[model samples]
Target: MKTLWVLVIAWASVAPAASMPVCSGGHRVNCVVDGDTFWWRGKKYRIADIDAPETDASCEAERRLAAEATSKLKDLLANDFAVEPTGRFDRYGRRLVIVKIDNKSVGETLIAAGLARRWQGRKEHWCPAP
Candidate 1:
């Protein structure tokens, strides 16, 4: 019985937990990774419906937008949200998912807020060509 209790406690420690707005790196289990990705219970997930600006983008505009988008995503995930898998994974092997809160798509929310754009099956660079 003691051994069983210890096992249960160990499992509980590694279980998926409440979302927290943390993106500063280093093995986060349940925290936002960026504008379009996050970690939940040691699993990485990519938002499947929209593409937010990338933090590594060369353009300053993109970098700023990425920060805002990331912040917005963090805010949304801070509450009770659902991670519905699309049964797919991106080229990078991140599980594709659509996050929702109260049946409203989180991607749509980011789009409405101008922090992200609909995923059109192609990469649309957020920086304008000089």
Candidate 2:
């Protein structure tokens, strides 16, 4: 009985290493990397399910938009926002989080602003299908 109790305690103390939980707590943290990619809670995060133009992609306008979107995101966050994970991870192994600041979604904002396009498939670049 004592051995079982000790084992249970040990297991309880171990934090889950895979699949981050959805944002349940109200506590917010600082943005360490705000350039299209960011980190929080000792975990590196990337916006999931969206593909923005790359800085050097085929489309010159898109590339510029990518940079602009990145900059805008940084400005919008700027240590004044809260985020919640969608309970998913991207291909790069970065924790995918749905961000909100002042009850506004930063991703949707970029989309509405024509800064980013919806991810067609599961890749990092945006491409339209025929």
The TM-score of predicted model 1 comes to 0.83
For 28-65, candidate 2 gives per-residue lDDT tens digits of: 34343333465555567766545566665676665667
Task: Candidate 1: give its CA RMSD in angstroms.
Answer: 6.9
Candidate 2 segments exceeding 4 Å error = 1-36, 124-130
Cα error of candidate 1 at position 3, Å:
33
Instruction: Report clash pairs, candidate 1.
Output: none
Quote the lDDT for 84 in model 1.
75
For candidate 2, the per-residue lDDT at 39 reads 53
Q: State TM-scores per candidate.
A: 0.83, 0.61
Q: Against the true structure, whose lDDT is highest?
A: 1
